[model samples]
Target: MPPAQTTAAPPSPAARALPAARRSLAPDLARGVMLLVIAAAHAHLFALMATGTDATLFGTWDRIATGTMTLFADLRGYPMFAALFGYGMAQIHRRRSEQGREWPWTRKLLRRRGLWMIAFGAVHVALLFFGDILAVYGLLALVFVGALRLSDRALLGSAAAALLAASAFVFTITFAAGGVPQLPEKPQGLLGELALRLSMWPFMIILMTAATLFPFLIGIWAARRRLLERPEQHLPLLRRTAPAGIAVAVLGAIPQALIKTGVWTDVSAAVGAGAATLHQITGFAGGLGYAALIGLVAVRIAGRPGPIATALAALGQRSLTFYLLQSVAWAVLFASYGLDLRVSTAAGVAIGAAVWLVTVVLAELMRRADMRGPAERALRRLTYGTTAAHGRAD
Candidate 1:
């Protein structure tokens, strides 16, 4: 059991808002890069309105773009995010518990944070991106708050079981139903698009929540182990898992790459569904691999991470703000209220990459000025209360 310090009151929220002097760079760095992958993945999904990546009309470069996105970006980015979510949650829980905050109060704080996330997500989905994950994560945090208390064995077992079951469920659904659910059509009018977004909320929320649970659980497990937080201590383990996870994830994703690239476009429905399932099943590796690789990088730079690393880490530090901004860029480029333009897959990916670069520069500016993201500041205040939310600009 953790030693208790209930005698002393917890630190003021304002003071707590300050950055950790010895913060782990791995998580922030990983998240910093992860957003790019996410942006690219999401951009491709929007591009789907134009045509399938594998469509015969696509030029060689387009096909190559689709294949690259398929193998490296799609079905791959979410795992890292999910794992990080769990990792961060564990950190929060542990910090409070160690500080002598009773479980009841801490859990309440977490649930409240989750509630705010849901609200943010609703607004985000309604106005900007249909692929928002904030609300799903918010709901997951609330639903799984109690799971943090579970023993390591229980957590790992549950994660494994969920992984298998979720994969099977997705596979079965695709296999039986022919493909995934149909998305709501893009509306040319701003109001119409908002309405369509709100309409699709129920289905998309359900899908995102269920699909991401496995990684969330794994994240919790990793946090308990302090995997990312203490990379130096876990180097041996990281070295082993990093390569293995990538290999599995890459290999498993091959079938998906083939289908998405149109190389195996003519396969039977059932066969195609199986390929999709294979991608889902193996995606765990991708998520785990990303975290591990980042962990290794963090270790290497434990002493000194130069300007580039510092900038990336800053972006990761304020990931929520950047994440939302990514959609805003997408909207201007693709939504009716904005450019209302559609491009080939390759072009879209390039656009996504360029937009992400913009954020990197923005993040560096924030870092240089020592400012926190506006969204993060608001969230901190909301979660902890006005006085408690007091923080430096950075």
Candidate 2:
């Protein structure tokens, strides 16, 4: 347990964030690869005014792409990241505790970071993307920081409760609504579009917070176990979870995939609602499965990581930058005021893949230059204030 002192500790001049050398490979690799999944998930949304995977038409390749993505990528990417976010928080706590900072000081630091993240998310939404998750995570830190002190049993129990609550809420909402809401007509200008996105941001925050809280809590539980950081010690658990969780995720996603691919058309509202809920609930498993799979990979490449692995870790380190860049790509490609490309789903996926590849290459270059991502640099400065350099430790 962290020290329970109510007073702040004297600030150490040398106190800093974890250095890159001390960082584990698995989380970075998971994040690097997860970006591809996230890209795949969002690419189609910008295809032709599609909000996300609601494409009305599909060719043969589109069907294949849609099926594969639904099985592996849809609703699967963010949960892993959410878990990583929680794990990161735990890491922060541990680091601060070791620095002789008690709970009060660490809590203040966390809330400070959370406030900055909320600011970052607001700008991200107003200027670039409507699907910003930074705000949701920030809000989580603000609200659930105390969860860090919960006992193991309490942590797991809370995770279970959050999962059930999310599932029930998803089912209830889908059942009541009966169908996906229609996309509003394109706004007249950039200002108008910004207004539309801002208007919806609050609701997205609520829904995403509910959906993500489960994984976030589970992530904290996993971190307490050091599951990702020391995968070699937990080989049996990782081996079992990778396959089983992925199997569940794929199997649960089938109904939704079939529905999307026109193979299970004319479905009743109840069936659709159930499928949606099932997809969401099982997606959590898929996310963890992907993380476990990455952990196994980390175990294998522990001593000698290849160029691909190296590049991926570099990208993961700068995931925030690339993520925002992706939003920029989407805005340029799909916005009514921009290219407004109405490409097919397959084409959009291709474009998304290309975008990811470009980011990978750029990330590799940045890594070689020993440079941090711009967004990360800015956030570090904001979060660490005058000690930003010592705080990040480059």
Candidate 3:
């Protein structure tokens, strides 16, 4: 007798969460959230620096606000963004292969994006803040493009090893030298800073390149495992990952926090720097942990539709526009050449929240009108070299 015909199971809830032809909304939403946190951090920095009175109505709140910001910075966001970037590259590769197309063009596309980003970042740094990450990310992307062909496991392992080695190297040099090298003490004025940054670009590129690789590798791993594609399959893994990540992040941040708070004295600084070598270990552990937690959250939220999540996803879809807009807005608000509000801690938090709210509302409105942000549309056109009726603004 012929064996009974085998039947395939229906797609699971998680599997259905994302369209087969499109990338996951969860990653985009996660990116949007990271951008908001970044804005908040920057706003706080501006307020702290610009406030005339050393103390104000918001002054008392700085400790808590600053602490929270510092914690968030150390725990998530940056790493998540980096990992997502790598994941995105993988997605591009997979899609191209599925279409029976060569991926060399994609490399050129990425390079173009990187070059553009570096150009934008330079303007941002010169006109706004020297701490901009765009240039760093752009430079790193160029490096990561070469690693796209590595097997997922190989990519992950190599990235991990590189992070460890780089961190070790940084810690050893900094400790031996008595501390991390910082920009010279007096604000060298804007032109001076620009010149200095240009001179130091090579070193910055190297450091940022190493720092970005691990996250990119993690992204590639996630794509290979279909982690983002099917979040439910990874729920149990995420549950275990979140708390572990938080613990590791806390551990990694302790030495830095102690030094910042004066709890670690000059004598302790030396000892702490030595101990901080362990920070690299914790950073890797915690960064991956947070990424896992966020991925898990995204998985859970995938099935249940919520307005906020939808709005965030919209923002993520148009992230390039929002990102550039934020930079422009911040430059206007904080730069000496612009309005230069430089209000205070409390005001910064308020402004950040306002920016987030406004961005969300604007993003939702644009989505409703079937419009992508101007910058995003332009980038897509440049990358794809086809207008193709994409990004219809209403």
Candidate 4:
């Protein structure tokens, strides 16, 4: 006899949290690549801490490696991450609303997530890496979501205001300091270190948010336009933006690159500040340009989803987990308390790339196994309670 007709169970909220069938490839792809870029960007900080100056830290491959990083990776990754974070935040809100979650509920969920993020970031910085963006993002998520309710014109205007104000503030400070000033302090003990890191966090977040405001704003704007979500629909815009944004970013970043590579080591403080101010101001364009370029790549890979892209996208999907992993790796390899490994400019980059590559493999494996990264799973469970995660379905 035919078995009693049975029904399939619905997808769990946990499963639903995974990208739906209609999930945009562009964002994931962009995020995956962004991690690598971020990894590269972060390596310099470790190197900087080890040797004091980012310009002098390189052992042998000084000019070429640092120069390459300056030209391509430095000051480029954070903006992309910021913009993408804003975009993802918008997506989260939109998805919840579409799923019939009320504003109050959605807002509460975001705040909870933001709180957890701040907690995680604090812990991360205390234990592992100081150059953590998680906390900054957590803070941003809490503060920036309010702007989502604004009208399009208001939102854009606010973003512009934020960017301009941030630039002006930083520019004035840079001008006062004479150029990209360095902040280095020696902590007496682990406790001192912890306090110092926490103390430094707020200022860093505020300053960083301002510098990267354009990306966050554009991310929100792009999300509203569904640009990344519907890449096919925005090809023209992406195509035009990809090159233009990149050009602006590169030109703007050149001064920093020159300084970083010691090409003009003796520039006056004012000149140095001027170069830094240019770099910071132009970084917005760089961040947006990078996103546009990634979108264009996604468009080209429309029919053919290659293994590399697939791996990158998987890495992107579990980016938070891998991002944390990067910090762990840095702690293990670079921190004074850890191995305290020091190497040439090229080697630091290689190490960072290697860590990121390891994550790509791990993430891809998890993707294939239909499992989430441990951090991701924890965050998801925290973000949406176990019952909701298990019972609710999209």
Point to the candidate with the largest TM-score.
Answer: 1
lDDT of 2 by residue, 1-394 (tens): 5444523464452355667767789999999999998887788656635434354466798888878888888898889999999988887787777677778877987898889899989999999888899999999999998889999999999999999999988888777767333445556578988998999898889889999999999999998889998999999999999999899999999998998777887877788889989999999999999999999999999978899999999999889899999999988987777787778778878888888999999999998988889888887777777667434432
- The better candidate by TM-score, 2 or 3, is 2
What are the lDDT figures for the candidates, one per model?
0.82, 0.85, 0.64, 0.77
Global Cα lDDT for candidate 1:
0.82
Query: How does residue 211 of candidate 1 score in lDDT?
Result: 79
Give the distance in Å from residue 51's predicted Cα in candidate 3 to where it truly belongs.
6.1
Query: Model 2: how far is 331 from its true place, Å?
Result: 1.2
lDDT of 4 by residue, 14-95 (tens): 5456343456788888889989988876775676666555665455576777877776777787788889988988888887
Ranking of candidates on TM-score, top first: 1, 2, 4, 3
Colliding residue pairs in candidate 1? 370-394, 371-393, 371-394, 372-393, 372-394
Specify the poorest-scoring 10-residue window by lDDT in model 3. 6-15
Better of 1 and 4 by TM-score: 1
The clash count of every prediction, one per candidate, is 5, 0, 0, 1
Task: List TM-scores for all candidates, in order.
Answer: 0.95, 0.94, 0.80, 0.90
Candidate 1, residues 22-53: lDDT per residue as tens digits? 67889899999999999888887777663433
Give me the runs in candidate 1 sitting further than 4 Å from their true place: 1-8, 18-20, 50-54, 177-185, 392-394
In model 4, the clashing pairs are: 83-215
